[model samples]
Target: MDSPTNSQKTVSDDEEIDYSIKPELYDSDLDDKDEQWMAKKRDGRTSDAVLSCPACFTTVCYECQRHEQYVTQYRAVFVVNCEVDKDRVFQPNAIPSKVGKRTRDSEKQETGSADNERLNPVFCATCSTEIGVVDIEEIYHFFNVIPSEP
Candidate 1:
């Protein structure tokens, strides 16, 4: 009859009902990008966070500039592009995932719901910055940055 409150439950409200001990479920201030977000340093702290392509220095992901290595996980892990949800800013590669069925199946199971999906390299449209790897559907982006680079 009306815009149901927490009383009249639905699929969308599974989060509100599940009382699991998932810390993320409780903390409302977590960003999904913290895992793969790194910062370009200037004065010990990440003062220059313009995460451009290391090969060409072309700006690809402008959002990376806003991410800080001090606060976030800063591990540079692979994440579902859906988790990033900043598709407009990212640039998916023209090529497609060339791996075999085994890898594809594994990737799908890892991320889930990416049926018939494949991954591709997300290089800098302008420079040599390989931001990460993403699926053809832009569903998953694998980006694991080491501590230092050439």
Candidate 2:
């Protein structure tokens, strides 16, 4: 086997190297496993697509999928109780309501203690438009939302 020579050296002592990187290597924090995870998080309607707010065309979230626990489907729209991996949500783009108690009006009829964290309304950070809801399971359900290519 040929050994790497000084001329073939790609990184310097001051530089960092992580061979486990995949495509979009600029995101050093993620690896092949993360890519695979993101790939698996696609929905039937919008496969590996970017989700945006229909009102203001603001970018809301991306690579979201239908809720695994309860699969829902809406007419004309692809997302039915859409959700993205917790790590994929861009905190600045997707705004969620403050932690509070779950209301009786929630989709699920189950009630919990006051201290229990409740589902939250998610909005577009830029437009403050109602985009979806984040359930107690921490899944984002996009309603009347638009999907765009990444």
- Return the top candidate by lDDT: 2
Q: Extract clashing residue pairs from model 2.
A: none
lDDT by residue for model 2 (25-130), tens: 3666557766576457543334545676777787566555544554441122233333333333333355365479654555333544432434465666666676
- Candidate 2 residue 145 Cα shift, in angstroms, is 0.8
Angstrom error of the Cα, residue 2, model 1: value is 99
Model 1, 1-150: lDDT tens digits are: 688887765656666665656655455544434323443322233322333445654433323322354532122322212133234344445547566645566766775663345445555555434556554464334253322221
Q: What's the residue-level lDDT of 147 in candidate 1?
A: 23
Q: Cα lDDT for residue 95, model 2?
A: 39
Model 1 lDDT, residue 34, Cα: 36
Candidate 2: where is the Cα deviation over 4 Å?
1-47, 66-117
